[model samples]
Target chain A: MKLLKEKVMAEGIVLGEQVLKVDSFLNHQMDPMLMKEVGSEFVRRFAGEGITKVLTIESSGIAPAIMTALELGVPMIFARKNKSLTLKEDIYVESVYSFTKRETNEITVSKKFLNADDRVLIIDDFLANGEAAFGLARIVEQVGASVVGIGIVIEKSFQPGSKLLKEAGYRVDSLVRIASLENGTVTFVEGE
Target chain B: MKLLKEKVMAEGIVLGEQVLKVDSFLNHQMDPMLMKEVGSEFVRRFAGEGITKVLTIESSGIAPAIMTALELGVPMIFARKNKSLTLKEDIYVESVYSFTKRETNEITVSKKFLNADDRVLIIDDFLANGEAAFGLARIVEQVGASVVGIGIVIEKSFQPGSKLLKEAGYRVDSLVRIASLENGTVTFVEGE
Candidate 1:
């Protein structure tokens, strides 16, 4: 977490006190070495929770989720943002609104991948309004699986997402948390 | 490669003569164990190519590209389909036509990720008409980076993608090459 915090402070771009763009390292252009460490940290935090699968939404979440799944020796299931031609029609779908893009898109996971017997860990790149995380959690609930925990790479603590998940009684862990992004600078949550 | 071939034969769904869906393992619901093997195989194939970076498009390609980047100890960059607000406007963009989706999406990679000195190894989940791969190659070329090779998980050899890459003198490697998908059954190329 310290390494991630340092990386964020060094490479993260704060835009207008709301968006923390980590495209240089965490999201768009990824540093797999750092990601592998992040995956290891997630495994360290949630390995004993009987996680049979790692679940994340597509695109950004796939990398860290894949790395975590690799570390945990479990399969990973990513909810698709848009229904692809190859994805089966019979899927557990949930609608998620992106505050950034200001559009609602349905996230889906195949019913074939998740089941009642599985215990899942939800992972994602960023946690802002928590719409994506809750949408993924809904899909897990629909499949009758248990969500062991949620792993996040970057959490905008100034926002409501992580707090919302905690209030829902879900254990959420973020590698790098931004406490405040006031005046074009980022402040990390002290001692977290 | 044998493991990948077996996975495709067992879990891959042949939607029609043209479409083979391996989302159950390779893309959507991923088997990280098998994918780790796939990554190792890619490293085995392209390890000596001096690849400074692993390049792929967003969504499906991120997993394998992540694994390969981990194996190679290099960074991976994914081209974004939608221009993210976080992404810089000065980007290397290319228009890619998806035969399956029947639409053109412009993929952009941040100008910060690639440079003239970089040697990129392009990786993707599927190679059909080679539009995505070519589009990625164009981005690499735009940055003045050399594309060392292109590694594909599944190649629909019946399509023109692989042939197009080969004709262009790009080193093309596919784990499983479908000779034909006739009668709704996959027929792999005889030896490789």
Candidate 2:
């Protein structure tokens, strides 16, 4: 977690006190070395849990989820933003509202990929309002699968995301927890 | 390459004689173990080209691209199909026609990510009509960066993607090359 927090301090950019853009290192452009360490940490955190798979949303979360799945030695299933041509008919879907984008979109994963047999760990890049994570959890419930935990790379503690996921009884582990980003200065949650 | 070929033959579904869906093990649902091997093979093929960065389109390509970047010890940059709120304004953009989605999408990467000093290796899940790969190549050209090679998981050899890329003088490598899906059977190309 220190490594990730340090990374956010070094490379992450603050956007007008609310948004933290980490495209330079975490999301758009990935640092695989740092990613492996983060993946290993997720495996360590949810080691004994019945993690049958790692689930995430498309595009941004795909890379880190893939890395965590590799570390956990499990399969990864990503919910697509739009239905692709080859995807099967049976699906588990949920609508997630994005604050940054100022819009809502549906995320879906095929029902065949997830089922009652899976105990999944959800992973994503940013956890701000918790809409995406909650949406993925909803999809998991729709498939009759158990969500073991949620792993996040950078979390905005000032936002309702962490509180929301925890209130839902999901173990939310954020590697970098940003408590405040007032005036372009980032402050990580003390002792976490 | 044999491992990949075997996976394609077994898990890959043939739809309408023209489409082969390997979502179970490739795109939607990812097998991290196989991705590691595929990534290693990509490094073996193009590591000597002095690739400063690993490039790919978003979603499916991010997994293999991360694998290769991890092995090669470089950063991975993905082109986004939609300009999300986090996307930078100063970007190199290209329009790509998706054969599967049946529409054109603009893919963009921030200008800060790539420059003339960068030598990129483009990786992707599938190469059919080559529009996605060409789109990435165009983004690279826009930044004055050199595309050293292109690696694909499955190549529909009959689709003219490889021929078009090769015509542009880019080194394109596909792990599994499908000669034809004739008579309800797949015929793979002799060489990898």
Candidate 3:
């Protein structure tokens, strides 16, 4: 977590009061070595939870989720953002709003992947509005699966996502939590 | 490779004449152990290639690419399928047509991650039309980076992707090459 916070402080760019871009290492162009550490740390945090599957959204979340799945020795299922011809009609669907894209899109997972027996662990690159994690939990619930925990690489603690998910009865853990991003400077939450 | 082929044979669903969905292990829901084997196999095949970076498209390609990057001790960068607020104005962009989705999407990568000195190895889940590889190669070329080779999980040799890439003078390797998918029976190319 210290390594992540250090890398974030060194490379993270704040465009506005809301936008934090860590694409140089975290999301678009990934540092797999750092990601491996992040995965191991998540495993340590959520160990003994009987996590049967790791769930995430497509694109950005796939890398960290895959790494965590590797460490946990479980399959990682990412909900696809678009409806493709290859995807079957029988699927659990949820709509999520993206503040960056300023649009709402449907994300889905095939019913074959999730079921009542699955103890799902949700992972994502960032948790701000908490919509993506909530949407993933909704899909898991549709299959009668239990969400064991949620792991995030970075969390904007100033945002309401953490509180919202915690109030919804989900245990959420973030490696680096930004306390504030005022005037293009990032402030980390102490003791995170 | 045997493990991958066995997974494909057991869990792969043949939808039509050309569609083989191995979402159970290879894509949608990924078996991390098998993917670890895949990453090691790719490292064995491309050993001593001096690959500075592993490149791929988003969603499905990120998992294997991340694993491969982990094995190779290099960073992995996935091209975003759409423009986002986090991305900068300076980028390498290319248009790729998805046969399954029946649409062309613009993929972009930040100019900061790739450079002329970088030797990139492209990785992907499926190589059918080879459009994604070609598109990724175009982005690398835009940044003046050399594409050392291309690694694919499953190649539909029945299609023109492999042949086209080979003819284009890019070294392309697939773990499993399917010769035919006649009547829902998947046939592998002998000795591949």
Candidate 4:
């Protein structure tokens, strides 16, 4: 967590009191060693809940989620943003609106992957409005599967995502919490 | 390679004569251990190339690319299919046509991550028409970076991708080469 926070503070770019551009190391260009550590941390946090699958959105979340799934010895499932030609039928669907892109896209997972017997751990790169997280959790519930917990790499505490998930009774664990991104600077939430 | 061939014969679904759906382990829902082994195999094949970075497209390519990057002790960068809000400028762009999705996506990589001094290893989940790999290689060439080799998880030898890439003088290493997908059966090209 300390390593993630340091990398964020050193490389994260803040824009207009929102939008942290971590393309240098976190999202677009990734540090594999750091991601491996992040994965180990997630496994350490959610060790004994009997997680059957590690679920995440495509693109950014795949790196961390796959690493966590590797360490935990479980499979990783990434919900597709668009319906592809192969993944066309018998799928659980959820609509998520991205505040960053300002567009709505339907995310889906094959029904063959998730079921009542699975325990899911949701992981993502960033948590702002919690829309993506909620959408993934909804898909997990649609298959009668239970969400064991949610693991986030970075959370904007100034936003309502962390608070919202906690209020809904989900155990949310974020590696770094941003208190503010005002005046072209980042502030971290210290001491819990 | 034998393990990968066995997985393909066991879980890969041949849709018609052209499509092979590997959503179970290679793509959508991923087995982390298998992917780890895949990374090791790729590392073994492309070793001593002095690959400074690993490059791949987003979604399916991220899993194997990250693991390869982890073992090679380098960074991994995924080209974004769509231009997000944060990734708007100073990028190397290439248009890739997805034969599976029947769509053309403009993939972009930040200029900050790649440059002339870098040696890149391109990795992908599947190699069919070679559009995505070509696009990635073009992006690398745009920045004056050299592509050491291309690593593919599955190569549909019936398709023209492998031939095109090899003719272009690129080192192509495929874990499993499929000879045919006829009559609802998966066939592998044995012994080169």
> Candidate 2 - CAPRI tier?
high
- Candidate 1 C-alpha lDDT tens digits along B45-92: 996799999999988898889889988999999999988777758898
Give the better candidate number (3 or 4) by lDDT: 4
Who wins the lDDT comparison?
A: 4
Model 2 lDDT tens row, B1-192? 899999998988878667988889888999999999999999998857999999999899999999999999999999899898778599888999988899999999999989898999999999999999999998999888999999999999989999999999999999889998877788898765
Q: Write the per-residue lDDT of candidate 4 for residues B10-43, one digit (tens) a residue.
A: 8999899999999999889999999999999999
Ranking by DockQ: 4, 2, 3, 1
Q: What DockQ would you assign to candidate 2?
A: 0.89
Residue-level lDDT tens digits of model 3 in B34-65: 88888899999999999999999987888888
**Docking band of candidate 1:** high
Estimate candidate 1's alpha-carbon lDDT, on a 0 to 1 scale.
0.91
What are the runs in model 2 whose C-alpha is more than 4 Å off?
none
DockQ for each of the predicted structures, in order? 0.84, 0.89, 0.87, 0.93
**Deviating ranges (above 4 Å) for candidate 3:** none
For model 1 chain B, the run of ten residues with the poorest summed lDDT = B81-90
Clashing pairs in 3: none
Cα distance off (Å), candidate 4, residue B137: 0.7
Clashes of each: 0, 0, 0, 0
Query: On residues A2-55, what C-alpha lDDT tens digit does candidate 2 reach at each position?
Result: 888788888988887898888988878999998889889888988899798999
Top DockQ model: 4
> Model 2: how far is A76 from its true place, Å?
0.6
Tens digits of per-residue lDDT, candidate 4, A52-79, equal 9999999899999999999999999999
